[model samples]
Target: MAISSEPRLGASTNGDLVNRVQQLRLDGQLGAGKNSRGGGGALLPWVLCGLLAVTWAGVGVRSYKNAGQKADDTASAPQGTAPAASSTNTPQPAGPSAVAEGELVTQLKGNVIPSLQITVSPRDVAAEITEIFFAEGKRVKRGDKIATLLDHLYVNRLNTEVASVAAAEAQVTRAQASQTSVAAKVAKAKSALAAAEARGTRATAMQERAGKDFDQARQQRASGSIALLDYQRFDADKQAADADKIAATADIEAAKREVEAAEAEVKTAVASTKAATADLGAAKARCAEAQRLVENCVVTAPIDGTILTKSADKGALVSPNSFNVAAGICLIADLSKLEVEIDVPERQITRLKSGQSCKLQADADPTREYRGVVDRVMPIADDTKNVVKVRIRAYLKKGEQQGEFLKPKMSITATVYNTPFTFDPSKDLPWGDEATRK
Candidate 1:
């Protein structure tokens, strides 16, 4: 409707231009509307995209730094060596360590033994076992009695011998008195013989005087001057004196013989007395012997020791020299003193000596140990085993307490050290030097 001034659509030059402008305006309107809708939707999307881009950038930078650190560590490490093998290659040793060694040592202490043994038995008296008075292992003095035997018969014999001695003594006294009586008879006989001799001499003188008177009377008769009767009387008197003289002489001789006989009787009585005295002495000796035998029947203790074995019992018969039906009484031993016999190797024995120190360990008690000194060493070797037999007297150390478990005949081991040995540092040692050895 406004066609008056406007160029018409079909006008030559301006028509095309005006239609093109209208077409451009319509296209611009559509483009503006579409742009407005898109702008509103794209606001939230663009904000989300910006936050994502910043997060991705931060992740990439962290990854790059981690890779760089790994590369640096790889370059710094040692090459061609495993970590486990490197530590294991160093050398280490194992075992118990050694302490100080190579000290000067003397003979190893050990046990020894007695070379000979002696058994004692009773003599002179019969032995009987009664009560055991001593314990085993105790000490005793000599001459102590150990047992006794019955002696009733010996006692009776002693009494009989004593009576015999008394009887013999009485016989000696009676014989002495008889000897004195015989001596007195001999003295009286000698005095009577002397008086008879004097009488014989007087009778012989009277007989000679009467004979002379008779001859003178005969002469007077011849001369017829004297009486015949007087002469006859004188002759008779001479005859009688002759006869008396002869008798007196014979009586003197007989008295002399009697004196000799009495002297002989006295000598016989003295001999009898001497014989009686000798018999008394013999009887007394017999009595003493019997008494000694009786006393020997009572036996006592021989030593203060315990009995190890009983060989006889009560009422068993025993002999002085032999055991007879019974075994030889009891055996006893002293236990206060102890000894051990050991056979050491010949090589080991050369290094041992008396009075050396020793350490002993009994197999039965491994934890317990004992200390002893060597009291003796044997010079000879054992013939059977070809080993050196040694005897050791072991005395417990003073003030040491022994356990009850210790006993005789227990097996034991001992350690002996060499004497006069030195530690040489220059030489390689089986055991190391002082600091390294045990």
Candidate 2:
């Protein structure tokens, strides 16, 4: 029988392909041998047909392997992660979930952020930077000193205020001392007034006795029973006694006036003391204010956090409030309070709420995933983007970090696996069909 020299697609099975190829080689050799030099065209066709047959066999084998490879790729391809038409990356499945089968998830782009990022500034506007206490990126606790500004002026003001307070206190002491002296003068004045009163009483008694003696002498003189000289002498004694009584009365008045003057001095001293005490209090208050301002010059971390940046250096002027500052002293944030800000479509805003579980993947590190929870769902919508902001708190545990990867402002994605599910005991019935289990 003559061997046909034509390529056939279905004529040979894979089991016979090798044998067919061998037979084609033999046939081509026999045909070439039978044909003469002028019959080159006839042998050329068989040789070409044999080559085509071999090529086709190899192609079939390659197709079979390719088919297996495609099947494997399809099997391994995870659910919900289909090759996107516009995307270069075919996103893979995230971490394990507590969610059961058939649960839906919402994926969104987001950025990692610190819960609080505040720029630390000096309370004094004109404060000159003196020293930086902490290096950038160092963690500091609340009340920890981060930097120091020039506090010499405030310190000086405090000193002046303290001196004023001390001076006022000295004045108060002087006033009190004056009050003590006045009190002594008042006591002395009372003693002098008592002495004056005793002297006046003694003078009054002597004057009465002298007046009676003069009256008796005058009566004797009128009766010519005594000499005129004796009567004259008695009159002189009475006049002298009257002068002594008058002098004692004048001394008593003087003593009374002294008492009044001493009492008045005591009043003046008391008023002085009260006024000085008030001045002291006011001075002390000013000193406290100066001290507070001086303390303000020393910049410190207001919260527990790592220093994010430092814009002020030694000798730089710092201020708490300014229309523009080259930058504040520094900015620090609590890294442990790291979260992600996701922009969810306004249409899908209802799909999320607080306490919903989520999966977070950083763009910098995609292979590793971190768990998170929907910390907040902003009710307000951004009209420009038609999106609502959602804040997710990362499930970073306490003590030590599993991985120190999350950082503020890092681009990331949040796969919100927030669908709620409850396992049905009936669905878990053993070795039973769905209808039977129910």
Candidate 3:
């Protein structure tokens, strides 16, 4: 049967038709074909993907902002705070600070010293050192026996000199006695010559008388008044008288010769006396020298101080000419008076002057300070070290007492304070304007 072209509103043949129509209408709302399922399923996945993308973008933005902030902090940080890879890096300098010109005072202390040095010289052979009476650090006084030399030989020589002097004096006395005796003999010889001359004159007068008698006898013979025998007897008598006169004259000449010989003896005696006197004087001088040498055998202290060094020992040969390597047997120093010697740079020496106040401090006793005055500043600087040796006299101040414990050759540091008259033309000085000129 042919279906009617007209619409049939309520003619439901099967229930499938109604259902198909309802499904078709549902498909239309959803979409058609593959798009319908794909679009619907993709909606949930797309939403989840959108949420993940948004979360990732937010994390990246946060990371970028944090990195930029860190870079800004790094750029603004201080340079000093940065670490260096090597140890050779230098540190930055500090801020500027003010500086001033001021004096620096120091304190020093030292041992004492002697003002004079004494040495003994021996004239004879080298002496053997008998004993050394002093040791280092031992205090000694003037005239104290510090050392001794062998005295046996010197004593013997002195004795010999004494004996020689005595012998010479004895000889002088003997010569003087001899001279007196010779003088007496000379006087006696002179007297004898005078008596002999007087006798000779008497004999000549008797001879003349005898000759006259002989002549008278010859005349008598001529006149025949006397016999020939008598006249010959008279002539013989006259000849005998003349011979007696000649003998008397010869005796007088012999007496004169004896007197002259005696006078010569006296002269010789006087010469001997003079020679003996000279020998006596020489002997006495030698005796005195021997005495002086004996006294020198006992050595004495030359100064008042403490012995600081000693090299002499018993049995050692000591000679003044010997090398003084260790400085004569012992060294004496005056511990009461201490001084410091320092070689100041030449540049600084010009600023120092004598009588300027100074301070000293010894390395041994740092706590104790000593005050002193500048004793001397060398006018010339030493060429070897280009320094001027300055000597300072340090007087112990009241209340600070270091007695005999101070020793010589101790190392010390010293500071010399500027004197009031020190000249400085740069600025106003501590002293008055007049001091500046000096």
Candidate 4:
């Protein structure tokens, strides 16, 4: 299969050789020669040689024709035209300056996503869905009602808690009233004790005066100056005063005991009031919890966003326990702020960085190009895919609004650039520095 560079006969020479080989076959010269050689095999070699020569001649003619045509084409080509690539030679890569302007540094495939997504579900309790206010694709604001759950149970519990709180409050009031009554009783007992002490003092003074009087009277009787009746009267008055003193002492002791009893009752009442207040506080806490649960029955949007999906329907039972397994009432997302999540090959991850500019094109709408910036490079890598997760924040062009075209979970391709791309007014295309283009 070697190609000889030596001058070869053209098509005419090839035609003549073909004619000669045909004439020899027709004239029986091939057979005559075979007989003289005593075998047909000897003649076979000559025939084969002739056929090979004719093939080479035809190939040479074709090569010549191709060469002439190439020459003519070269002559007609405009000046400065690049030469055709040589199959034998490897192509040299473009130099940094030779690269086209605005060429992407790297391209990655990913999915469009919302900047924030939330799942709306019951907080802790399970309930049957009673109503849904928002539909898929509907725009909602923060605190807007999204759905309602069966709240009879919560309402009942709240009522019970309220009653318990009221009861606790009544108990506290009664204990406080009892405390006041006991305190008053204590005061009364103290007053009685004070009165009994005053009477005892009076009785002591009377007893002293009476004893003195009896002694004076006895002296008079001894002197025979006073009558015996007078002496006896004085003695009788002394005994009465002594008996009054003893009675006053007993009354004072009894009043002191009553004061002690009353003070003890006051302490007991104070303890009861404190216990009742604690119960009231506990009841109030329960009441507050019940109120919260009741409010939670009316599910609300957590942020201003669009409803992406509705997983729960009316009458469907939902619970926090099965939340991991079951979907929520609806999926909400902020469509105004979108992002692209890409798993860049580990080899290309080094070139990616936060704040780098990017261009995004959704598979569903490749004609439109969305602007984006590298938002983050996840610290962790995917072990199975040997890739690093990268996030890009997508933005609409000036005068463009976030529409339904770009949606969450849409497949998208992102072209990352080393620098921000600037629009070239004249070219109507993006442009960048030579380094960036390279």
Q: How do all models score by TM-score? A: 0.46, 0.60, 0.57, 0.69
Clashes of each: 21, 0, 5, 0
Model 4 agreement with the true structure over 12-88: per-residue lDDT tens digits: 77566566555555226545665666665446547766779799899999999999978864653323445445465
Predicted candidate 3 versus true structure: per-residue lDDT over 30-125, tens digit per residue: 557646556563354446556766998999999999989777545432223342222457664343122123343222233333333334333443
Off by over 4 Å in 4: 1-104, 221-224, 323-327, 420-438
Q: 314 in model 1: Cα distance from truth in Å?
A: 3.7
Task: Output the worst ten-in-a-row residue range by lDDT, candidate 3.
Answer: 96-105
Clashing pairs in 2: none
lDDT of 1: 0.60
Tell me the tens digit of each residue's lDDT in model 2 across 1-438.
988877566765754655654555544556775555556545654676678789999999999999897775454333476632334576644533234433445677889889778888877546778789977778899999887777788899999999999999999999999999999999999999999999999999999999999999999999999998899999999999999999999999999999999999999999999999999999999999999898887777899888887787888877666666544888888776677998876546766767666777889979867767677887688999888999987755334442266778899888876553222333221112224321
Q: Model 2: what TM-score?
A: 0.60
Q: Of the candidates numbered 1 and 2, which has the greater lDDT value?
A: 2
Please give, for residues 1-438, the per-residue lDDT of candidate 1 as tens digits: 444866656678545644654454433545667666665533544565567669989999999999897775454222332222224668643431221233222222233222222233334556454443344443344456655666767788999999999999999999999999999999999988988988888878877877787778778878988877876787788889889899999989999999999999998999999999999999999998888877767554454444445555556666646634553556654433445566665544555555554455667766766554344667788778666866554444334332233445566555433232233334212222235422
The Cα local distance difference test for each model comes to: 0.60, 0.77, 0.69, 0.81
Scored by lDDT, the top model is 4
